[model samples]
Target: MTRKTKPSTAAAVQMPLKEAEAGKETNCDEDKPSDHPKERDNNVKDNDGTKPAAEWKLPRKKALLQFRCKLEDAIRGDYLLGRSYWSLSRLSRENMSSASSQPLPLMDIRLWGVPLLPSKGHEGTDYVLTKFLKARNYKVGEAFEMLQETLWWRRQHRVDETTGEAPLGPDELVLRTMYVRSVDREGRPLCYHVYGALEDREVYKRALGTKERVEEFKSWAVQFMERVARRLSFKDGGVDSVVQITDLKNMRSRSAKEARGVLRSTFLMVQDHYPELVHRHIILNVPLWYYTFHLLLLRLLHQSDKSKFILARPAKVTKTLLKFIDPEDLPVEYGGLLRENDEEFSNLDKVSEVFVGGNTTKSIRIPIAEAGSTVVWDLTVVGWDVSYKEEFMPEDEGSYRVTLNRSKKLRESVRNSYYINEPGELVITVRNPTFKKKRVLYRTKFKPTVPMYVFFKS
Candidate 1:
């Protein structure tokens, strides 16, 4: 029921040495909202005076239809399905019937749970087929070949059967370094490839130490992808791809070189085996040479592959990510409100936004009239270069005001709590000293608790 295929690179690669995390993070996708942020002008030359490749766009209807028709014909004659190969997993040849034993006329053909037969009339069939076609630039011949190889690779490696931690035997930490964290603004799964985690020499060695280790990690990458795939809905108008946010801070050149074998092969596997599955590949905290490296990639990678990539240097890391992800879903490290193992808030908490214009001040007040209540708040001033402080203002002016935090400069998000014993308002003040506007995301909640006596019943 399975076959294996060895992948051959059809293009040059510039994979991150820390993880299988390249090729994601752009809002220019076909199904993205019309209000998607504007992309940088590709024609605009960088300081090196060289222009990057044209921005990727969905193929025209005529070309798409033409390629789809040709692909249908090829699939009809493929040996995998009654010589038509409407699928790689064909129905059993013997028909189960009480009257006669003629073979079943229908072949139950499918890929990733989506029926591949053009005749099957599955709503997602076109969407899935176009992915392969686009990966190969609308070349029916190449797309068909890629599909065949992808199915064989899945079968040979038993990819769909991949499960649990490090299925192919990579270090445990290797699995932790990359995985789905949450969904993006559009509901596509948001995955973080924290290459920074690999800076640990032991972790790096265990993952990319030898040829065998590299292959093991490659298998781990494939298995990791299967988990991400399970989260997707491969139907018309469904979220069928993932957004990759790769953090490359502290990645050493030596480590990168050591990881090149795994990185390159893993990148190639994603390209060949899971085309169009990456919605955006956002590279964060890139070093100085990232521009030059990316320029070379723009020239080498196919339009479909290169277009998903977005790079953000240390300073721009937050701003760049906020464009494609919502403030709530994005991790706090990237200037969003998200926190690991956070007990104070959930996605339903509803973060509110405010703007503090340059040389201006803004204030947020949360009224808590209930006595013996605790107030917890999470706040962030994007691109922070501001001074801020919070205070407990008592409704009874005679009771006096308490300064919770003294005014100070901040460069990151904030999470704090205060107990309120009386009716008053928790006031937060932000002063934007810079010459540019600052956007703030803030949320507050009230907590309930009981005396220790409540736990006494055994």
Candidate 2:
């Protein structure tokens, strides 16, 4: 008998010869002559040897297709047109071209004359651009135009330099009523506005009479925003958003009416230039009439903007304030742990004299006997409005420069303390531009130290 041929170990694990020859079956387990022992060991380790095949998770075909389609739609629709009512020509073509090739390019963002890009450190350009796009319904051209117009407005008004210059004489009222006092839990600057504190409405109205006054108001508003931005730009744990508290505790009908114009103008300016700056707004002690005004304001704001506003009555003011601010950082008057005797809150109302009436001017001159001394003043006004100007006229022929030029209205108070570098006369002037008579009260004292210590007893 002929010697029986034995099948090789590899042939037993492979497909039958007839099936392999016909190419109708593949033997995945069959070892090739070119395969190395190391490769085989890796395969065996991956499959655990006893198992015939390795486990694999295949993606769902339908789900993958759906995801791809949605992604394409997002890029072609939202990113390109921003749900705009009007269609753009080049953007449409670019969108069509991007569908077959690469991703769409974002529009160029510029401030003043410099181009800006979004990066890990700074997202300001992207932030401002997205706001404009949303405001214009994602029409790239219109959004760009809107952004350009705002930039031009800022440049024409020279908003960046407003902080260094003397505030318009009328803005003193705003300074007294609206101011940034402290920081919140997130380190964002906390701005406080006490609408109820306004004692006279007619004074504010008279102060806001001319176009120049209105422009000045806007400039000061922008300057405040710039100051906030500078704070945010600091490297030491700065925040980009601001927390605003508007207290309407004693707001009257006449005061509300007078404030409407100023409020409207400020709202529009904020919406246009400083987008995404206010992270939260707490409106405290809101009266029933305020809801009507709120509704009107809602018409001017985007839907996204509405969510940032929080309304609270006097009873719930503390609870609402505690949400975004720490008790330690909040002022004592606002139900926080900080004391009224703290440096930030102390002597805010330490006024000495009070005047009432209009169309009058007053001047006071104090001759400084010694150089390098300090002059401290506590001044306030009641009834109408007044303009304040101070100058240091040297004994010699040195030119006198205006140190303070601010206007005040209603019952706001101002405290000014400055040091004299040279021998000069401190000339103070207060003028009432309105026809109505207003009361003025002021007190001053000379100090022998570099930093004045008028309030402290030795």
Candidate 3:
């Protein structure tokens, strides 16, 4: 299901002369049917270009036959050309995968004697083209078009437009071709396309001076980069190809270029300004949470101003979270704060004071990474598990620890233990202990010293 926008006027377009020079001759009757067509009565020139109109006139049936033949031949040629699309794509993928540490093969990138913009000096171009396509495995617009057309055709036949009826059969979508275009950031025109996938977003955005579009692409790209950074831990791929569209003969003034340059710079400047948006693609059976650390990681990655950095840290999620800050580097006060708030240090039976009274009671204000499976806490104890607490003892002003003994009747079970940072997301999760054979078990719990709604009296 893809909806591709139309290409800009500047996108690459192959004119007849260029096509001819490339050995893509227009001599075939399928391409130049009028060149050799039996002349019409209106004094059209025949193949020999010497026939008079009266001699050239042919019956309508003959004209129809010639058109049919031409169409058939055209279809055959189109089929061969279309098939080459898949072959070229496969070749591209293979070459990218095998590209050495030396650099992308520049000579192989030329088209009809005109060389492609090199990726050597412009590192961003290589990263954008190779890595992005490698991740997606390029989509063929021809196939997409066929699917879209088929679906539309079926939809047209199955539904009663006036009555608002249901479709009679399974709906399908098809797409055939895509139009491509290239424009400079300043709206300077470059190339055009008849059949191709949507231009790479980063490349298009950078070239077109589309701030919003560039940000959208950067956000998506950053997430992808983060995933690759974490999982594959590969240093090879970064920003790839950069395609430029400009007036070839210096038709534009220096001011024009400068003006566009400002807009392009501003767009890149704000690329990482927003938090990442990660979401589950489908309904889920269990609770799940997503926390993005790309911004933090990027900052750390850039701090050194070096070309290479080795991540020797373990890959476990908890370990990764712990690696966020070097324990030794933490300030004494902040270290104490972390230790004080640390779940391991807090006693389960205590009402923990998470925030101090001040102008802002916003300590530990992390956004809710997950909204499913509401955490349940024992009112009498503050802990993840609270099955057997026998007694509660206060350790500090707003903290308590509980001793648990299931056999003792002196303790009371605590209920309503956990609170969610975000509401309205609990429906997606199963309650704790619902699926596991092991019964609910816990020793202690804790709560805030000053409940959020409570105002401190002077």
Which predicted model would earn the best TM-score? 1
Error of 1 at 230 (Å): 3.1
Task: Give the runs in model 3 whose Cα sits over 4 Å from its true position.
Answer: 1-83, 86-320, 323-402, 405-458
Candidate 2 Cα deviation (angstroms), residue 435: 54
Superposed Cα deviation of residue 71, candidate 2 (Å): 25
Tell me the lDDT of model 1 at 313: 82
Can you give the TM-score per candidate against the true fold?
0.74, 0.46, 0.16
- lDDT at 85, model 1: 32
Looking at model 1, which ten-residue stretch has the lowest summed lDDT?
10-19
Ranking the candidates on lDDT from highest down gives 1, 2, 3
What are the runs in model 1 whose C-alpha is more than 4 Å off?
1-109, 118-122, 161-171, 448-458
TM-score of 3: 0.16
Distance (Å) between predicted and true CA of 155, model 1? 4.1
Q: How close is candidate 1 to the true structure, as a TM-score?
A: 0.74
Q: Write the per-residue lDDT of candidate 1 for residues 15-64, one digit (tens) a residue.
A: 11011123333222433222112222223211112221122233433344
lDDT digits (tens) for residues 7-51 of candidate 3: 322221123223423444333332111111111123222112334
Residues 1-458, model 2: lDDT tens digits: 89998653233312232242244433322211121111111222110123211121223222222222332333334342344312333444454443433222333323421222222112233233434544554455555556556754664565543545555335377676677876665456787766654655565555455666656655666776665544442111124457777888877666566456666676677667766567677899888888888899989887656777899976667667867765545565665544444442322333243443467777777788787677776554443246777777788785566566554443345557778777878777778888866555555666677544655757
Give the 10-residue window scoring lowest on summed lDDT in candidate 3. 275-284
